[model samples]
Target: MSTSAGQPPYRDAEESVGDLVKHASEQISQLMRQELRLAQAEMRQKGKRFGRGGGLLGGAGVVGFVALLAAVTTAIVALDLVWPLWLSALVVTAALLLLAALLGLVGKKQVGKATPATPEQAIHSIKADVAEIKERARR
Candidate 1:
């Protein structure tokens, strides 16, 4: 007998218990693999965010050091000469400090965003899937 046009050949009117169990196993395995992939992608994204935050923080530190040096130079120049050069150095130092502050704030925000970097969505999905499986099994 030929199956209907809308149906596949393997999906008959009735399936054996073993076939059902095997299909369920395959489905569960596929689900696990998908969850794993999701978790890995999430972790990689979090890692990148963390790396960006760390780089920004390092830049802030370097800028802060430059600002310190500029301040010291400004003081020394002000003592040596009575001109606008000291004032210019002071302005540069202020600008560097502002830039460093901005970088530090942005880096802190990035790090905060990436904190507790767990695969939250994947975990929720897996939990929901398990709950659904349990509910179905009760029937």
Candidate 2:
């Protein structure tokens, strides 16, 4: 049977059930592939960001360690000029301990705020697509 010019022949209500099912299966497969590609691309982008961030943090740690060493040395030397060497060393040690404790507390608080890391954007997109498909299917 022929269909109107505005309608596709394959989409006609009179189309065979097997043809309709096959068409739907193909569409679903295409949608799944698209979603998978999106997720892969998203993950790859996130991986790059994580790699760069880790490298930057590592560099910062080295720089901070060197700076901390110099600062401690300066503190001890400056104190020793006015006080005994042993007392200067003790004071510097106490100050470093206090600074470390403060940093530990702040780091703990920040860590508490961290979410269970996942590909949140990809998950959300996939969920939305599923919801849309479900809504359409309901029709």
Candidate 3:
């Protein structure tokens, strides 16, 4: 269809069809690029959140480790007054090792859970849009 009052005769159907196909292709490519950008942004956001969470967790773990060491030192000092120093030290070492192992396990689990925090909603939205576009094109 003519877009302006003084436009020439309308193009042939074949030319129009080619133009429509080209426009559709361009639109689809633009849409795909937009979707990719959205995905990248979402991934970067999720990465930042995970990085912050990981840093906090690491700090907490360090604090816990230091606290455990202090507790072990105090326990060994108190026990040494009543028992042999070597036995008290041995007991404190074993307790500290056990606490360290448990803390490590908990930290590992927390880190594992922090992965893939970005929601699948964006992907689903893109899929829905693609389906709708396909249906419209078919019609």
- Model 2 Cα RMSD, 1 decimal: 4.9
TM-scores for all candidates? 0.59, 0.77, 0.68
Instruction: Give a tens-digit lDDT track for model 3, residues 32-123.
Output: 88888888888888889878988998999899879977987899899999999999999888887897799799979977987666647679
List lDDT for all candidates, in order.
0.83, 0.86, 0.83
lDDT for model 2, on a 0 to 1 scale? 0.86
What is the Å distance of residue 35 in model 2 from its true position? 1.4
Error of 2 at 43 (Å): 1.5
Q: Report backbone clashes per prediction.
A: 0, 0, 0
The Cα error of candidate 1 at residue 59, in Å, is: 0.9
| Decreasing TM-score order of the candidates | 2, 3, 1
Model 3 error, position 105 (Å): 2.8
- In the range 23-127, model 1's lDDT, one tens digit per residue, is 989999999999999999988997898789889979997998899787777675764576477676666667777978998999799779866868998999999
> Tens-digit lDDT track for model 2 on 94-126?
999999999999989976876565667778887
Best by the TM-score measure? 2
Worst 10 residues of 1 by lDDT: 74-83
